[model samples]
Target: MGDVSITVLDGDTLRSLHVSLREDTVSLTGAQVLDLAESEASRSLLGLSLPQHLKSSALRRMNIDGVDDDVDFRRKELSPEEASRKLNEYLSAIADELKDNPLVASNLDGSALRMLLEDEDDFAMIAENLFTDLDTEDKGMISKREIRNAVVNMGVEMGVPPLEEFPLINDILKKHGAEEEGELGQSQFAELLQPILQEVADALAKNHFAVIHNIKIVNGSELKKVLANEKKLNDVIAKIKQEKDNGKSGHKSTEIIKDFLEKNGKELGLPPSEANEAVILLYDAVFADIDSGKGASEEEDEFRKLVTEILEKFAEQLEANPIYCDLDG
Candidate 1:
């Protein structure tokens, strides 16, 4: 097996995966990967027994020498069945080695997880395990709803998650999943997560958005596209900022940009659902500023406030709303 980072685009689709092993990285997507999140199958063909967490395409990373395939994986395509078989061989081998470690299975219950979640590292490990473990049928991606469901079930099974929290998490994840009509692919996901992650990141920054003038508005795939090998997106954002006068006086002007994105994003052949998601992404990112208590920077505050007001248009329309970002912030 090789070291790999699998990105679950949106909530259900497997957007991209880059594997790293011995300094060699091979990224794959679509049908290129096989058994990305397998539960159980063949085993006995791996060096490191992959725990359940590692089974997820998002977490499987191993060192395989003489396997530098980054360019090839992206430019080349593989037969679905062939890719599946080769990938399965690796997964089975890893699973067999870790068979005894049920803790390595989907229902991750181990002494280490219990102790670790309690520590200050903040159980960031839990987030890892949450996203990586339990692939259902070993597909490259796991549904956001499934992950939360696993937690609620496991919490009850292990006595960790409160009964009250179980329903709440279930409701939230379910609501999010339902809002998306079940699954989210890369673009849809970028619409939701970029803002949420940026907001979360901002919260970690001195507790608010005002503390930082320049913040990452997008993350995951959207970030990859706009910022990859270029800084065009930053130019777009900066151009908008320069024209603004800082507070309510200049706030109305941003609406034009928003109108442009909303209209051009639609007229130029992008999906309206995706545009809706983009709007929400802005909301979530600004929610970080709102929640920070310090508010946005002098120049950015009004723009953010306009964004805050725009969030109201989304209302209970879950797919268009920031979902967790609204309440969380």
Candidate 2:
């Protein structure tokens, strides 16, 4: 209605909210207020905070027509693959929306742009504030100067260094075919940025699958911590896979791995007591993958002996009473 005001009186505090609408004035209790807030019209006009009972009542009212039934049923029926595809489609739409704004397109570059493309929440936040420093007068478009200023503002907000120059923005424009004298429009900027964003999405998707596969192959979660960089994840996975063909396994290798694990175990997602044991288990799996039914190599045998010795040293911490091969059963 014309204006809706919600006033809540607690023991000593009074909270009030005012919203304007074309409907008539109405006085409603807190529950009624919540019910009214559920309607699309009410939400479009203003936000209201209501208690649980009223919120439930309002939700029931909104669904009284059964318009949401089919959508809810479909959501419940969606498979994991279907849900993932739908989410990707939604993310792609949001990424595309970013391209339609020249100031947003120009302001993003370097690590900031990479993160924006990869993180939907971060991208939305930046896009929401796109017009804060730029003027949209040239046929609803931003100029080169505005783009430069926007980039500097974005960089500063992101805590990036050296705001005195706009080299990153200039470089982005040039790469997107913006000439020194030519004009840059939102559409053109978005079109050029689309491919880069797509590449980022693709890389992220590939890395995600690769990480899952590698973790499964190793049958371990210890790698998750040290594999912070996708490139490093790829490298480590490759090395583990090629261990049979090119891997060096021996007392020296065991010593080196043991030292690495002991020093960086916490950072690698392994506890101090089990760090050496995790490396031993991982190497065993890797060696098994490479052996192809063959026996362990002489070097591998030596490494295994060292690992056994190391594990025996930590036997008290492991709490395992099983006898070693050298001990009588």
Candidate 3:
């Protein structure tokens, strides 16, 4: 029920309303937003996410299967709390859309979705070329030139449209000592674009472009900073639990989460490979339904409002999850 417009009612009048959707199916228990997945209109919102969005989501859940869940189901299913078990099938289907596009999934970032939304055909062609490298005789490794070709071709997938702004691309190449006119020929180039792509994806995912003044690659030691703030989040959540009316909106509360991994996001049990996953996870938990620019500006302003219901659900998960039962021992 990603970004669904849910209308709750009792009889002839509206009782409450809900609207939450995603570019991909969100992890059921990742945060506290199970209610967002339970709307009457949720299924109607599933078709909008791009295939890349769908694929990465599946891979992520698959990767987190045993560890993320309380019990190991080994790619089968897990014993999540009531919140976690709500919509497993729907989430799995979205993830299945990407099963064949693993390498492409590796290259996914918010930037790609931004490009896709700017122009669909360009994105389609770039995807076509990007995946071509996966099937090549060279053991499924795509060349930087191929990546460049895919990106630039994103300017015109059908070979018919005018190119939009690609300043981000030029900046990416320049940072690598690569020439503006130079073709990206090294795998390092793909590595180089990761942050920019992730930033773009984040912007697209959240619909608010947090300018990438400069890309700070997440290394092996950034998690310390991200988690340092976790205490702040835990404390706030604790306070909220005590009061049950901390009055913080879910989106704002998530902003305060202070990922302990931010500093050493790649180091403290974090993988640079999945550094961007944090942002995606955060946004997925909060908001990832609007792939295009639709209601983005407004969403930003009302991000907390949008997350109100999910936040409440998280509070419930915290109290009801069996992990707590085990911890209580």
Which is superior by TM-score, 1 or 3? 1
Task: Give all TM-scores, in the order shown.
Answer: 0.21, 0.22, 0.19
Residue-by-residue lDDT tens digits, candidate 3, 65-127: 334452333334223443344344334433333222111101122443554435645544445
Candidate 1's TM-score reads: 0.21
Among all windows of ten consecutive residues in candidate 3, which has the lowest summed lDDT?
A: 1-10
Expressed as tens digits, the lDDT of each residue in 43-161 for candidate 1 is: 22111233334344322333331224433442455454445544555454344323211221111123323343345343444444444455545454555445444444344223223
* Candidate 3 TM-score versus the reference: 0.19
- Report clash pairs, candidate 2: 1-21, 1-23
Per-residue CA lDDT of model 2 for 208-297, tens digit only, reads 211000011121233332344556544443443244345445334443544544554444333443434554654454334332322333
Better of 1 and 2 by TM-score: 2
Q: Flag the better candidate by lDDT, 2 or 3.
A: 2
lDDT of each: 0.36, 0.35, 0.35
Model 1 global lDDT (CA atoms, 0 to 1): 0.36
Worst 10 residues of 2 by lDDT: 208-217
Off by over 4 Å in 3: 1-146, 154-163, 177-190, 202-329
